[model samples]
Target: MLKARVITAIFLLIGFLAALFLLSPLGWTLLATVVAMLAAWEWGGLMRLVGIQRIAVALLLGVPCTTLMLAQPEALGLSGSLDKGAALSLAWWFLLPALGFWTLLVPLWLVRRFPLSGTAFGLLTGAVVLLPTWLALVLLRHLGPWALLGIMALVWIADIAAYFTGRAFGRRKLAPQISPGKTWEGAYGAVAGVLIYGLAVYFLSGSALALPLLLLIPTLLVLTAVSIIGDLFESLLKRQAGIKDSSQLLPGHGGILDRIDSLTSTLPLVTLLWLVL
Candidate 1:
């Protein structure tokens, strides 16, 4: 598993660098949309929306949504004067439904006992899990490569820190019901790692720090917490479905969704922060 993970990481790093430095920003946007669409496909399966209808629905819903999100600055709102920051903020704010839906699913999971049995319920749940994340990716990509890289770095740092911390010292389970392996210690590590990473990026980019390091630290910490929630949220979904990982797309990482769960939650918040403050 570790070897596979290393291999996958190498490939992902190569791809990301290529996209960031070699490809046009437009190309990055296109690639991001494609990834979003693929995630939507995986989401359809998780939702129990299988067969041709599932594909059709996912494409119909995911494609236009991804396109509009990516094109939001120019195509959807405020015409030419549309603020990228504002648009990202709005997207994050709009993700409330997805968050609410996930919260609601907790009770359902506890009550239904066999929650994943119903196709309709699964489809709705899947939509809640899938759409926001896809939209977040679109918004991040649209924010330009720097913003996208920043978002990605946060997720990556969180995951890496969480893994090492949890392995080194993980006595208390953070969410044993959802993901037994996750630990509070690891969660804290994730927060710390991401905040430090955010600070590094902020300084390295030579961007003016409108806010103090203290303020930025807390913001990144909050974003890291949100990212963990996103991972646990998806883990809960998979647990109820009697599945492990979102898909077998990656040799060790599971699927795109598995790799991106943190980003799914963090990106929107980052986008919102970038715009609002």
Candidate 2:
């Protein structure tokens, strides 16, 4: 299992890097939309929406995603304006759903462990989580591919730290029912790992979170925890769906949502903060 996972991860990283660096903005946008649509399909499965229901869900998401991208075809370019054009207007729109879902509802759902399976609420939750993350991907890629890459690296770092550290020294449960594999020690390790990465970006890259150095660390820490929220939220969905993985779409990676779960939370929030400041 471990070997399969490692090999899949390596190939995924390679393919991802190639697309990130080589694709034109329009090309990247199309690729991102396809990925989001696949996640939407898996999300529909979790909602127990079958056949036509799943196809409906896919079009429901894809149509709006197409609209958003069409709204700012140029803003996704290196020369596009993020301040005055469609991107800015939609950024404000994106901010509300992402913030509301992550800040108000998700934490409550996590604490309460609400019975959200196959419900309208679960469908709404999937929309809220998936849409803004898609928005973030487009906006960040437009800003610059490097910007997108750096922000994603933060989530990647946190996940890696949590995995290895949890394996080595995990003790107390982070959320026993939703995700038994998680641990408080792993959370701490993720924080430390993101901290190191954040500071490295701050000092070395000089592309820290457009905030004071002291303030950036706290922001990174919050984002780290938020990434965990994203991970656990999907785990909860899979739990309610009574499944071990979202789907066996990626040899060892489970599915699209399984791979990008953390990004679903972290990316939108990070982009919101970036746009705000």
Backbone clashes, each candidate: 0, 0
Which segments of model 2 are wrong by more than 4 Å? 1-7, 74-85, 117-119
Candidate 1's residue-wise lDDT over 184-264, tens digit each? 999988977877777787798754224566687777776777677778867876777667977787888887888887777
Candidate 1 has what TM-score?
Answer: 0.79
**Relative to the unseen true structure, what is the Cα RMSD of model 2?**
2.0
Best TM-score among the predictions, by candidate number: 2
Instruction: List pairs with backbone clashes in candidate 1.
Output: none
Candidate 1 regions exceeding 4 Å error are: 1-4, 66-129, 142-144, 201-210
Which lDDT tens digits does candidate 2 get at residues 1-277?
8888889889988989999889876777788888988898888888877788877777778988887666666545424455435555676776578887876788898899886665577667777888888878877876566877888889999999999999999999999989999999999999999999999988997768687897898899889988999899889878988888887778888999999999999888877777666
lDDT of each: 0.67, 0.83
Error of 2 at 172 (Å): 0.9
Question: TM-scores across all candidates?
Answer: 0.79, 0.92
